[model samples]
Target: MRRAAKADDNQPVIVKSFRQLGWTVAHTHMIGRGFPDTVVSKQLPSGLKFTAVIEIKDGAKPKSSQALTPDEVVWREAWQGEYKIINSIEAVLEYHDWVMKKF
Candidate 1:
């Protein structure tokens, strides 16, 4: 048997790993279709909360279509401009680690 692979097949796998690391993860499930796939936040012991928006893509060839859409761009610009385009689980964890040091 064969399986079909699309651009966002890894989102659930990455979300599961993110949850294991103590982040409160949420799927945008954007019915209107103008946002990132996931949003997550974690709190430090020092009472600092770090939140991030992540857009996920499959680690496949021709990475062009995975780029952020125009509306997603608007959302990032309105925020702290800390948006991430992720294709791997490690990148997601690394992003959290990078945010951890800031708090």
Candidate 2:
């Protein structure tokens, strides 16, 4: 379990780590409106841009019931983002590696 207050805290760590690896990343789940959890862009040395939106949740699983919730489902459908449920800072690091590989 985790405090809701810092639930999305993984956003910056992931962003910074990726940036160190030379990825251009932004927090874009907001699409503006202050909702973006993390938006990452990778501009290859070749000038191609790869953009990915990541939503980070700490210490909680995304309940199917919640996903079925009206607004949640809507965002899931429209955002094309990822729901990452992590329990610790280490999880965030590991998950970041996994997601990058996935992309």
Candidate 3:
């Protein structure tokens, strides 16, 4: 059987949405030893800036291979600040709005 292909393409989609919303997104997420998949940043109108880490996963499948590893859990448990494990573009947009209210 042909495995799901586009399922692994969610990362680019998330990145694009973040860019559309005026946030700077990077594919190299070196934070916490590269536990996250993407790094996102934005400067609000008030000159307030914030950085966030996102871990993208394909939640469309019940048994998707995007589950976090043990290392990721350990890092996430110790890290601080904005972080999220997103599965869809809508979730990314929703989180963006939620984070915007913080600054």
Candidate 4:
């Protein structure tokens, strides 16, 4: 299996890919909102706002042998807006598409 990516590595990759596609993105922690991994502002070419909280993680699927990590599960459950769990570029683009369609 591929090794998991550290936040240091994954964060920039996610940001760069989405920003290049024209989304306004930020690392959530940097904004003093200690919640998601990234915050994305989905916009139309005409600049309408479609925003959501996003969480990114690079890991194997959660193992049945172990219980959910409390902190991770808490954030996952408590998020109050459109949210997605993404691990690959396809998934990110899928999310952007879904946001555009929904909001």
Index of the highest-TM-score prediction: 3
Decoy 1 TM-score against native: 0.76
**Candidate 2 lDDT over residue span 1-103, tens digit each:** 4223232455666556666766666655444332436666665554556666555554444554223335444565676545543334566568656655665
Q: Candidate 3's error at 52, in angstroms?
A: 0.8
Q: Candidate 3: where are CA atoms >4 Å away?
A: 1-7, 29-34, 63-66
**How many clashes show up in model 2?**
5
Over 4 Å off in model 4, which ranges? 1-8, 29-34, 45-47, 59-68
Least well predicted 10-residue stretch by lDDT in candidate 1: 1-10
Which is the winner by TM-score between candidate 1 and candidate 2? 1
How well is each residue in 24-78 modelled by candidate 1, as lDDT tens digits? 9888735324567788788877898778777787765367766766866776677
- Measured with C-alpha atoms, the lDDT of residue 98 in candidate 2 is 62
RMSD, one per candidate, in order: 5.5, 6.5, 5.2, 6.2
- Put down candidate 4 lDDT per residue, 13-67, tens digits, no spaces: 7778788778888776443223567878865765678777766655344535223
Ranking by TM-score: 3, 1, 4, 2
Ranked by TM-score, the better of candidates 2 and 4 is: 4
* Candidate 2 error regions (>4 Å): 1-7, 28-35, 45-47, 59-70, 80-103
Report the C-alpha displacement of residue 79, candidate 2, in angstroms: 3.4
- What TM-score would you give candidate 2 relative to the actual structure? 0.49
TM-score of 3: 0.79
Selected candidate, larger lDDT, 1 vs 4: 1
Which model, 1 or 3, shows the larger lDDT?
Answer: 3
